[model samples]
Target chain A: MHKIWAVVRREFVERVRTKWFWVSAILGPVLFAGIIVFQIVQSMGGAVRNVAVVDSTTDKLGPKVIEALDASGSFRATLAAAGPGVIDSLSNLVESKQLNGFLIITDDLVQTGRAEYQASNLGMQTIESLQRTLGKLVVKARLEQRGVNPGVVDWAQIRIALDQKKISHGKAVSDSATQSFFMAYFMAILLFMAILLYGVNVMSSVLEEKTTRIIEVLVSSIRPFQLMLGKILGAGSVSFFQFVIWGVSARVLLSLRGPIARALGADPASVQTMVLPHIPAATLAVFIAFFLGGFLLYSAMFAAVGAMSSNEQEARQAQQPVTYLLMVSYLSILGLTNDPSSTFARTLSLVPFTTPIATPVRWTAGSMPTWELAASLVILAIGIVAVTWVYRVGILMTGKRPTVKELVRWVRTA
Target chain B: MPEPVVVDRVTKRFSGHTAVENGAGKTTTLRMIMDIYEPDAGSIRLFDQVGGGRIHSARIGYLPEERGLYPRMRVLDVLVFLAEAKGVSRRAARVKALEWLERLGLADWRLRKVSDLSKGMQQKVQFISTILHDPDLVILDEPFSGLDPVNSQVLRDTVVDYRHRGKTVLFSTHIMEHAEKLCDRLCIIARGKKLIDGTLAEVKHTHGGKHVIVEFDGTQGNARQIFADRQLVAKLQDFGQQAELELATGADAQEILKALVNSGARLARFELASPSLHKIFVDLVGPEAATAAASGARGANGGANA
Candidate 1:
């Protein structure tokens, strides 16, 4: 154990002190800072919509619609006079770039509740707000015509907001699907990138050691299994360090969003919406567990590849299948996020190859069953043990790179 | 004491092909003793610990034929780390490594990256790391293959020092010179089989000493004819002033030397000569096996073996 720890310490310190580690470590936070700065700068450049309203209905809703559109404070609504040529005139204004878009309320709108919106780019947010504003106006005009009690109508119009809360144990916690989605997305990418970077770091280290013949010296004093575990733990710790740094930096930057927004002369209120998602302690534990499991599974295979290979090119060639396996898990994150409890998604979460990223994502989607998580963890543990054993025998191999068949033979015969 | 290492019919075949063909079995055999590979059949005992039993890794120092250290690491750090990994504490490892560095004349280069050092320097550092933990049994595979004469001398002296410290130093080499010079007991292996095993004197004695050398001032061309009556000379090389003669089996070297002196020749020198290790190796293992062993590009023939 002490020897293993020594190996781990050496691997960690030697690699951590490298310029590449520092560069990549600082690079992540810096990139995220740059993104926040970019968002702030974009927000500072305000969005102004110049929309014209064309009313062809006998209800003569153009002026009222103009007032409502202007009241939204996002669009500058102009009343285009009702005429047979109003559509052509408004479209001409849009084509000439004077208007961002034009909204047409036809006589059939009251029955169909359909209105035409044309723009060079009709953003979803803009379209949703436009519909809400026009729908309210049409409803009010119809209500007044039907002689509904004005006071009762005013009371009935009051919108009651539903507060979403998730009950865990005895406490109700605020749960936002949007927040969960964003959180899951962030963590999935974090896990994928971390695994790829550090797992390959282990691979390349093994290959370099093998090529330089340092492994022979190392194995002389420690079992190859100890060496492999120490290295995986060492590199995994570095990845964990990076994860913590990025996580803390993200939290700090998120909390500083208001000041950053103010610095950019943008609205602090808008920036306040960029809150850090609240990850439950249990969920955090699960995330870390799966992260390690996934990392170990791949890193062990990579170490085997490194041991079997004679050089960097050969190691890379041998690593292709495993790399593709990782890529498949990463690419499947999107589909898993959409339907975390779906048969395909749940099944993938059970598979050792995809379980690391997929299981955590399913958890975040609030659909991961406890049994599945436990089963995957067990499967991953067994896989790590098997891979470590196979690669320990592999580290003894020298000279030419072994074929897949040869490696399998080593594993079986050993 | 129990033999430091014993391999009893140990065999390892990788994917149906034996590793012995290219003499790679040297490495494979060492690995089995180190428990890096389990033998397919037979058994290996280290200090009477059978079934590849747990020998403290620190008790054994192995310098594989493919010698190396962490190239990007500082020399001192690499050595200390290796020692520590062998169960030496950090402080003790550091002091010992420094002592070794100084002894190897690499004290000044301790702070330098291994890559910054020359190949020979790196090799010396690697050698230090192997024995820094003061292991009881030191196994070096082809230790002198890549070294220049000076470094090889340095390594040879180190191995002598190890033996003086009462350590069992077992090293594998295809080149007979290193084995002949350094080993008290030697084994010649070919095609994964031990062809010869004995002390240096014993092996030479076994190959016999019926060879005689004579340096004379008189007749040079008639020397072969002088011994022709008894057909005593199996092979003879006349070097003008000096000649060598390998006697036929049962032919007496003393009788031949006396005959040469009585042939009215003023003799300058005459002595029976024992076969060299090169001759013994070629004779015992056969020339083809020696050729294949030397083909690994790590062995030297020392003129005669060539």
Candidate 2:
């Protein structure tokens, strides 16, 4: 055990001292902050578009449309009389960048609910908002024409906001669907990237020893199994440390969202809508359990790949199968998150290869039975044990990369 | 006293390949004694313990034929880590590592990365790591294959120093002179078989008989006819000015001396002596096998120097 600890300390200290570790660790939080700042800036909106309402209707509906568009605060609208030269003039204005777009309102708009919008270029959000405002005006105008009170029509058109809440243990929690989905997505990506990145790190470390011929000296002193286990645990600790840094920084950033938003000249309330989801203790436990389990499971296979390969180019080529296995689990994440209770999702969550990322994502996206998580962990543990056996034999092997048949033989014989 | 190690008829095969085809089984046998590889047919006993596994790892120091160290690691740190892995305490390992570094003229390079040092320096560092924990037994495979004369002498002295301290040192080398100069006991293995093994004196006594060293005037060409008399000489290793001859069965060494003088070759010295290890090795393994081993050693030295 003490010898194993020595190997662990050497692996950890050697890796942690590299500049690559700190750069990548800090890069994660910097990327997160960049995304947050971008979203806030987007929500504050761009310069209002200058557009004209072209009226060809006999009832002068263009004025009302212009008034509604102006009130929406996304467009600065002007009333223009429809004439033969009116469109040509607006086209020149749009071409010269003086006009963002122009909406043409005609008698056919009320009849067919169709209108032509012309512009040099317009954002999707701008077009959608314009359509909503025009639709509402047409509906109200039609209601008044039917002798319905304008006040009643306006009152009936008030938007009703839907409140989303998730129920846990027979209590409805105030976690919005968007918030829950965002959290699940975030956690899945974090787990996937961390596992893949650090698992490859383990592989390179093993390859470094093998190519450098250091394994001979090492195995003479300690058991190969001890050396392998020490390496996995050491690298796992580095990934865990990185995750903690990212998590704490994320929390700190989320709490400072108000100040950051205000500094960007965005409404603080708009930023507040993006609250950090409240993660239960059980969910956090599952996250950590799956992270560690997945890290061990994949890193063992990676270490074996490193051991079997005799050089860097060979290692890169040999690690593809293991990489593809992790990718399959990651690719299934979107499907699992969408329907966490589906048979496909449940089966994937139970399989050891996919369980590490799948189970945690399913738990966060939907309600998962406690028994399923436990069973998944058990299966993952078995996977790790089996891979570790392969790793033990592989680390001492040199020369040609082994085929899958050889790898199986190693597991059985070792 | 119990033997430190006994590799009893050990056999290890890699798939369909014979382990000893290229003389690589020397390293393989050492690896088995270290428990890095398990023997299929026989057992290895370390310090009189059967099936001891790696329990004796801390007691046995091994320097593999393929020399390497962690390139990114500091010189002192790599030594300390290796010693610690051998079950030495960190504090004691550090002190010993420092002392060894200072003794090896590497005290100023203790903090430098292994890759930054010269090949000879790296080799010295590896040698230090091997015996850093002060093991009871030190096994080195081809330890002097890649060292410059200066570093080689330093290592040779350190190996001899270990012997003076009453530590057991078993090392293999393709250079017969190295083995001849340093070994108390010798084992010659070839073609997956032990050709001979015993104390140096015993090996010499058993394998030595009717050997004659003749130094004469003129080149070997001048005495070719005298050596070509197979009736008198069984084998001849011509060294230009001197030749070592093994007498044919019942031929008598005095007969060869008379034949040489009769041929008008001026003989400066003629003496009978036990066969040198190089002569014995060439005779036992044949000229071809001996040349192969020597060339392999040269290739390794060239690679290291390059």
Candidate 3:
């Protein structure tokens, strides 16, 4: 036990002293916060567009179209002068960068309901907004011409947006659909990144020791399994340390959203109302459980891969199967997020290889059944036990890459 | 004291082939003594300890043939950590490590990363780590490898010092000179089997008479014919002006020298050979086995000497 602690302490102290550790720790949260800030600013507004309207209708609706576009506050519209020269002038305006685009409203727009808006470059969202503005103005003009009361039409318009609520045991859960989805995605990604980064770290450290021949000196005083476990736990601790910093930073940044919005000349209450999901205690527990269990399970396999190879190049090639396993689990997130309650998702969640990420995703999405979660955890525990046993025996092996048959034989004999 | 280390009919095979004589089994044997690998059939006893019980790691220091220290780690930290791993208290280990560093002339480099040090200095640090816990028995496999002459002499003195302090030391080396100069009792292994085991004198005596070297001013063809025709010369190697002859059992070197003179050979040099460990190794394991072992041929288990 003391030997194990010595190994652990050595690994942790040696790695923590490296500049990479501190750099990544600080950069992870800062980058995450930067992305959130950029998103908020993007949602606030975009650059206004200048456009020309060519109305060929008998009703002379060019002024009305310009008025409607101007009221949207995103477009500066002007009525084109009559004649073929109008198009040439508008094209020249676009070439001179004075106008972004020109919209051509044909005389048959009421019958055909089709118009062309041409621009040098346009984002889909901007184009959609322009289409909706013109659509509403055309309908309003037609209604006014047909003798409909403008006040009655305005009163009849509705703004309907669904309020999504999740319930458990006849009590409403305090999570919106968007919040739940993002929360599940965030947890899955966090766990995935942590496991892969740290698992590879453990494997390469083992490889480093092996190639440098320190492992021979180490195994003399301690069991190879103890060395392996010490390294895994040591790297795990570093990852956990970084994760806590990011978590705290995230919480602090989220709490400051109201102040951030007020600084940006927006209402604080509206920003405050967009609070992060209230993740239940059970969900958080599941997240922690899967994170640890999955990390241990995969790290053991990676350590075995490291032990079988004599150098880093060989280890990288030997690590392919394990890397592929991790990639498959990560990619299953797409299927999982699409429909967490689907039988396919449940099956994936039950598989030991994929369970770590898949199960937590389903749990946070409010779709994972309790028995299924328990069963998946049980399977994952068994996998951890089996992989660790392999690691213990495999680390003693040196020289040459073992064939798959030989590897399986070792597992059986061990 | 029950002989610090004893191997009785120990056998190990990796990938169904013998890996003993040429480094692979040397490491395996030492690891077995360290309890890293349990023998399949034979028993190994270390420091009089019983087989099924644990040996205190502090009482054993091993320098493996394939040696390495953490290159990114400081020399002092590496030594202290290894000492602490063997159950030494941190403070005591630190002091002992400092003393070792000073003794090895590496005190000035104590804080430098191992990779920043020269290979010889790094080797000394590795050596220091092995003995830091002050084990009763020190096992070193190929300890002189990758060492310059100065550091090699230092290691030789250190080993001699350990023996003077009443510690049992067992080391393996392919270079016969190290074993010849240092070991009081030596064991020669070939292809996973012990070929011969005894004191240096005893091993030479049991193997038989010494080999003789004779240099003379003579025609090369004539010298070859003279040696080839003689019954006393069991094996003869002609190197231009010199010829080395292995005398047959019970054959007298004086008789051969007289015969060479009578054959009209102008003698430049003639001497009765002192038996060397290399000659003994070649005689015991056979010249073919020695050559194969030298060339690193795998899975060759020829005849055993004992």
Q: Which candidate gets the maximum TM-score versus the true structure? A: 2
Candidates' RMSD to native: 5.8, 5.2, 5.9
Better of 1 and 3 by DockQ: 1
lDDT of 3 by residue, A1-414 (tens): 887888888888987899988898889788977876775565454446888888887888788889988998788888886677888888888998888899888766666678888887787877888888878876777788788898866665656767777774356776676776677678767767877777788888888878887877777677777888898898888888878888899888887877777787665654434545577887789888998888888888888888888888998888888888888888887788789899989888888888988898887677766898899999998887777767666666777777878867777877
- TM-scores for candidates 1 onward, in order: 0.83, 0.88, 0.82
Write model 1 residue lDDT over A1-414, tens digit each, in one string: 888888888878887889988888788889999998887775553455888887788978788888988898777888777777777877887788888899888876777688999998788888888988888877777787798876766677889987877554455678866677777677777767877888888888888887887777676567788889899999888888877888898888878888888887888876637446778998899888988788889999899888778788888888999888888888887788787779989788777888888888888777666888899898888778777877877676777767668666766766
Question: What is the Å distance of residue B95 in model 2 from its true position?
Answer: 3.3
Give residue B278's error in model 1 in angstroms: 1.8
Judged by DockQ cut-offs, is candidate 2 incorrect, acceptable, medium or high? Answer: medium
Clash pairs, candidate 1, are: none
- Model 2 lDDT tens row, A38-155: 8788767554788999999988898788888889988899988888999999999999988888989888888888898998877898889988998999899888878999999999
- Candidates 1 and 2 compared by DockQ, better number: 2
TM-score of chain B of each: 0.82, 0.88, 0.85
**Evaluated with DockQ, which candidate comes out highest?**
2
> Per-residue lDDT tens digits of candidate 1, residues B220-290?
54566775645688766556787767788788777776676666677778877876676666766666776
Q: Judging by TM-score, tell me the better candidate of 2 and 3.
A: 2
Q: Number of clashes in model 2? A: 0
Alpha-carbon lDDT, every model = 0.77, 0.82, 0.76
What local lDDT does model 1 show for residue B133?
85
lDDT top scorer: 2
* Chain A TM-scores of all predicted models: 0.79, 0.86, 0.84
Report the TM-score of candidate 1, chain A only. Answer: 0.79
**Best to worst by lDDT, what's the order?**
2, 1, 3
